[model samples]
Target: MSEEPSARGEVLIVTGMSGAGRTTAANALEDHGWYVVDNLPPQMLRPLLELAGRVGSELPRVAAVVDVRGGDLLAELPATAQQLRDANNLRILFLDASDDALVRRFEQVRRPHPLQSAGTILDGIREERRQLQSIREGSDIVVDTTGLNIHQLASRTAELFEEEGAPRHRTTILSFGFKYGLPADADLVADMRFLPNPFWRDDLRALTGESEAVSNYVLAQEGATEFLDAYVQAVTPIIEGYQRENKSHSTIAIGCTGGKHRSVAMSLALAALLERIPGLRVRVRHRDLGRE
Candidate 1:
């Protein structure tokens, strides 16, 4: 909802169809530092969450996998999820794949469908899809695993949870070059070589973009002003998209011929622009600034 960090335990309840990669998602969350419980009954959802919350100091991240195997208790999931949320901060991540994909996967693995007693595997899949529509809609994040490999899924999940360790709650990595100036890896990268060359400024020639005088001089340019405006417009959507996709870290690289003049100036500008995005962790790096 708010995407704000919660003091209560962060619980990821992973659910979906039988062949929809729920187990893979659960395992990936576990690898990403979540304490995971697989195939727990819906009846145990409340108690397990309570236990996790009490012991969460030792395990702040928790994930649980629930599926149709829970039989009648499976129907209670919506209520259980609401109760858990009322007690703590709970997030549902529904993992799903296309029915064709699921059928192919089950065939490849040679696993019988749990609901096969009623009809064909396709019928079971249709039934499962119908049953899971509500949960799917309620999920905080819906990952379509139709074409994703296990490694890609794990990497994506790690990115989503990367904010857990940040002090500012936002993590930004901005890369700059010394030639064209700094590229705002956040809002925009502005080229600053059009301004008076700080490298040729005699007294300021040896200073880097991080230097206060170079920073001040670069900011006092007409191109820099226009660049900031254009850059903000260009970079805002990328940042928003990354956040929506649950990216934990991002690197914005701005390059100049030597990473000393323009690149450096632009990097500083980008850092300042990114400060407007609340709770973002920001850092700047000059890639070739020190290279001889």
Candidate 2:
């Protein structure tokens, strides 16, 4: 979808270090509306592409996860990918991370590396790196997940495949409470706790932000409008830059003490203002609206 709409669909091969977040990248691609096939052998590339070719637009963007598990079949990837490069809109996305990061991830999951083979995790990583040298060099995109957490990795994956010139940038303005754990995926966080808690008001205690009265009350708070305006101004350029870099989605979390009233109202207000930014698609979602 990053290119013009055509009869042909795009094929992406997602591969690289085992603990380097290949699954996470595939999940991100799936969220971005791509059809993802995990742990595919290189030999199946032809059949899959052929199937997609027949299906046409229905299976437009396909991402296949390939890895060292293919054994000797792994050798076929370079040739196969090159053969389909021009005709199939083929791309290779290599996910990678530092050896230390990969080792830590494997340890946390209590799983040994696939190539460990009577050796340490570092040994498996080193062997995989050697095996993947040529493949990595041939890849169209190489993302290092060393510095990125899961959410950021997902955001990067979405951006990698976002179509040029499309209104692809999306912002989910989320409302939550501070008591619940922080949203691990949020890109921007705003605290609406400064506003008066509608939960404390007798008349509005049971009312939610969707109600006209609660929304008005929250928005009517002294600095509410100013904060909304300032936040909108601050994020406008950031969203614009994301588009320029092909980043497709962002989450802005608005939190109040209880999330039922203040955060939800501020979220709606921010969504309305953010929608005015030309390239952004805005939606408001309350994550902790009823979790009192």
Candidate 3:
């Protein structure tokens, strides 16, 4: 069946091991524009998703944190997710870290474990891990944050939901050598260095891809058509797979030897190609595009 216009928004179910940064991630998702609900019961998941779908269409994004705190009812989550899928698109992200990290976080916070009320932190960690194994395995994305600080985690989370500029939902960052031109970061990367160097194209020299003249000159190249054909072939399937999985964001990087000219042109082209995908968000950045 054709996907409903993405239902106008998304529901992200956030769960994972204790002390694995679910709270932090939820906060970051909120910063990136997601409306968040924390520590809701698993039994209420179906009803909540339905309500969110009814209301979230106006909000654009929603996230919830579910974990062992649900007590015995936590086991019912997987089934609840399956049931919700018939009416709404859902993505589950399970966050995890090393046992040592979990223990360290607990000690740092000096809070009693919900499951460890009767035992050591180690015991609590083990039980939580055992109980969560199934959910973790079923997760669409598993983020291991053992070494990531709050900033790094926030950056990663923001990358998933940021909706401006290049393709926001599914981006590919491709790196390549200038001599070989741009790598297949998207469906196409046009090399403009061989063109009447925009850097030397009269009044247009200082303009980057953001300008109409530079864009026109790059698109006017003979190789542009050939590259676009090959690019679309290579990029179409990757994006299709991401869409099938209901991904919210992707980053594809295109790199040339100096990160200028060719890579920039191709990156812009790839961003354009991605725009054709329904509801797919795209974003592009040329890491070395301005470097001398």
lDDT of each: 0.71, 0.86, 0.71
- Tens digits of per-residue lDDT, candidate 1, 1-292, equal 4232334577778898787777767765664567899888877766776676567578787888989888777778888787667557788888888888989988999977887675788888888777888888887888888888765676566666644554222444454454444444544343445666677789787888778887788778667777767776787677766555445466766655667766677777877787677546667776677765
Sorting all predicted structures by TM-score, with the top scorer first, yields 2, 3, 1
Candidate achieving the largest TM-score = 2
Cα error, candidate 3, residue 60 (Å): 2.1
TM-scores, each model vs. reference: 0.54, 0.61, 0.54
Q: Over 4 Å off in model 3, which ranges?
A: 1-6, 164-292
The window of 10 residues in a row where model 3 has the poorest summed lDDT is: 184-193
Give the per-residue lDDT of model 3 (tens digit) for 44-105. Answer: 76666556656755676778899998898889888877766666768899999998999999
With a 3 Å backbone cut-off (N, CA, C), the pairs that clash in candidate 2 are: 2-163
lDDT of 3 at 181: 50
- Model 2, poorest ten-residue lDDT window? 1-10
lDDT by residue for model 2 over 107-132, one digit each (tens)?
A: 99999999989999999999999999
RMSD for each of the candidates = 8.6, 7.3, 11.0
